[model samples]
Structure formats: structure tokens, C-alpha cells
Target: MTERDELVPRRRRDRRGRGMRGPAVQPLAATGHRPPLPRSRREVFDKIMLDVVTDIDARWSEHLGLVEYAVEDAPQLPDDWDSGRVPLSSLVRGSGTTPTRLVVFRRPLEHRAADRADLEAIVLALVVEQVAELLGIEPHDVDPRYPSDLDDD
Candidate 1:
């Protein structure tokens, strides 16, 4: 072998091997922010709750004509039933053109799911249900339907 060839470094092998793949990540959080503080189950639920809220804002802020929306953390509940809880309560206080309110019970929703996929489905469903209820429309109206062209594949 030539001295120049010997001087060159060899290509390193992929650590995960040929066909292995990592889990897909959703754009759940902002960039360059402090890592979320998830000490208890509530914190975990809070993070997921925020994701759902953000998704709503991204998808329907203009359509809903919403100036703003908030996701209040679920109040502390009994430890025995707080792992993945999501409780929903709504109120119409103002006399004229009352603002919409959506409260997501974090602990109960989290408890209802067995895994991340389940958690995502539950969160999306909860958001859809709440938004639909607020708008007095069917839940399907709030859900994002796939384009018909995608079904042609």
C-alpha cells in the first residue's frame, strides 16, 4: 500500500447497523429552550398537554377566530388516580360573545393511555372533542382529514 493511502483514516461503520432505525420525533417543543422539568406525572402530563394545545393553535387558530387560548394544568388530584389523568370542564360566563375556554385534565388523560402512541391518540381525541364541543360542531369537523389523493397510493 502507498504511504498516502495508509495516512488516510478508514470510514467508520454505522453503530446501529444496516437496517436499524431510530424512533421518529414530533416537533413538540421549541428550539434552544431549557429542557422541560418533568419531576412528577403531572409534569409529564403538562408537557403533553402543551403539545396538544400547540397543535390546536397551529391547525385552527385562524379558522376558529381565536385571539388566544390557554391550557391550565390539571389541579392536583388523588395520587391513586393521577398517573395519566385528563379532565375537561367548560364555562360560558360572559353575557354577550363569551370567550371560549378549554381545560384539559392532565392526569386522567395520561392514565388512560398505555404508551406514547396511545397518549397521542388520546390527546388528539380530547382536543378534538373539546374544540368541537366549544364550536358546537361534530368532532370530525375539528379533526384534520387526510387528502383524498393520499389514498390513491
Candidate 2:
């Protein structure tokens, strides 16, 4: 071995200086030969949230002024959080120049739901309830599809 080769460590040689090694396990989502999997849970949740917001906004655009919607993977809770229930969403009303901000906690809602349909129902119910609170009106007034209305159908 040359003087430089002898000085360097065996593991740091990078496969005898050929190139970097590939990952030990390939991710199935990236493999080209197989059919692609469905959209990610986050993505699906995002779409559902958008659809619900769009439908509601169309009817309330004049009064709502401006609103911001967001989705977080999970909420950060304190070590000694005393509450037994975790919040599924948060709504911060706007004042003056600030726009209303609504945030949905994806993980908590997904955890409570039994299936895709249940997730949709939960998201719709929470969003409508929050929007109603913001507007100081009944949830059914915000959206006819609110949980109460679902029972009549």
C-alpha cells in the first residue's frame, strides 16, 4: 500500500475509493417497477381539509374577510398536561389587520378515527364547530353537513 493509503483508516476509504454506498434498504415508494402506493396520510388529510374549507368559504366569503388554514402533524403538549383529551384543532380569531388562523392537528384526529370515512366526518365536524364559534352562530348554520344534520339524513 502507498504511504497515503496506509495512513487513512480502512472504513473511510469509501468502498476502496470507488464511490459512496447505496442505502441498506430501498424505499418501496421510490421503486419504479411496482405500482405507486396511494397518497400519503398527510396529503389525503390536506385535500379533505381544503375541500371542506372551500365549500364553506364559498358561502361565507363576504363576512369572513380573510382566513388562514393549516395542518400540523401533531400538537406539542407539556409533560404534565392535565387534560385527558387532546385538541384536534385550534382556531385563533383575527383582530384588526390579522386574519383568522385555523390549525388542524392531523395525528390526533387520525388516531380517533376508525377509517377514511370516519376521518372525513371528524374533520368536517371540528371545522364546522370552530367556524361557528368564530361567527358566533350555530354549527349547522355554518355548514348543513355538520354532525347534527348528518343524523337527520
Candidate 3:
């Protein structure tokens, strides 16, 4: 061994003697082909909304075909509105040649829901209300599960 080789420990040196050994690392599992992670909360919410639309469309294909469903991160509140207050969860807009669009605001709905089940109910109710508006029918006519008492006097 050379004088320089003698100064360094055997475990620390490679054949070149210039480089030091690093800690051993195990190979990662073969995860490349594994299934994707579960859907995100927002995606799950959107799916719930879509499912409601699909069910409604099956019953009223002619009416639903002309409408569009959308998701927004949050409702655009008026500047005069209180900061601590949450805005409406959904809105239906359009008329005449324009396509009727039902937009559900995700953050406000999530904030209002107590849990997953509650969120599902809230989304369904919103969809029903909007569809009823589009069809000029009562919300209960669209989805019987929608509470009749929710209508303003």
C-alpha cells in the first residue's frame, strides 16, 4: 500500500482511493406500475355532482342535454359581503341560445358539509334545484329527496 492509502481506512476507500464509500441504500419497490393514488377530495366532489347529473339526465335527457355542469373553487362574493361569511354553494345561469350552466362552488360546499355523506346530499340538492330552475319545475319534481320546505315563502 502507498503512504497515502495507509492514512485512510480500508472501508472508506475504493480502488481509485480518491472516493469514500457512502451508506448502502436499498432498492425502492417496483411501484412504477402500481395503481394511481385515490382521487382528490375535489375530484370526489365533482364525481358526486356528475353522478347526480347523469341520473337526472337519464330521466330528462332532452332538457339536460342543453345544460352544462361546472365546478368553481369558490363563489365570487360581492365586495360589500362580510369576510367571515361563506357565499352560496351553487348558481344556475343562462337563457335563450346560451347553454344553461350549473356551477357548484367547491370550497363553500366543502365548508358547509359536515362530512362526506353530507357533502353528497348537499351536491345532489344543489343539482336538483338548478335542474328544476332550468326546467321551470319544482325541485322535488327533479329529485323527490329534495326537501320541499327549502323553498322561500
lDDT (0 to 1) per candidate: 0.60, 0.85, 0.77
Candidate 1 overall Cα lDDT vs. reference?
0.60
Please give the TM-score that candidate 3 achieves against the real structure: 0.66
Per-residue lDDT of candidate 3, residues 21-109 (tens digit): 33332223533344446799888988888888789878877776577778889887788887786754555466788876777788888
Residue 70 C-alpha lDDT in model 1: 49
Please give each candidate's TM-score: 0.49, 0.71, 0.66
Q: Kindly list the per-residue Cα lDDT of model 1 for residues 15-134, writing each as its tens digit.
A: 545543333332335333454554776666667768767877777777665433445545545667745633554433333466555666555666678987777667777677667666
- Cα deviation of 20 in candidate 3 (Å)? 28
Candidate 2 residues 1-153, lDDT tens each?
Answer: 899989986786566686653443345455434545689999999999999989988898787789998999998899999999998888888999999999999999999999999999999998888888888888899988887855453
Error of 1 at 121 (Å): 1.6
The best-first sequence of candidates by lDDT reads: 2, 3, 1
Which ranges in model 2 have alpha carbons more than 4 Å from their true place? 1-37, 149-153
Q: Which segments of model 1 are wrong by more than 4 Å?
A: 1-39, 67-87, 91-98, 145-153
lDDT of candidate 2 at residue 33, scale 0 to 100: 47
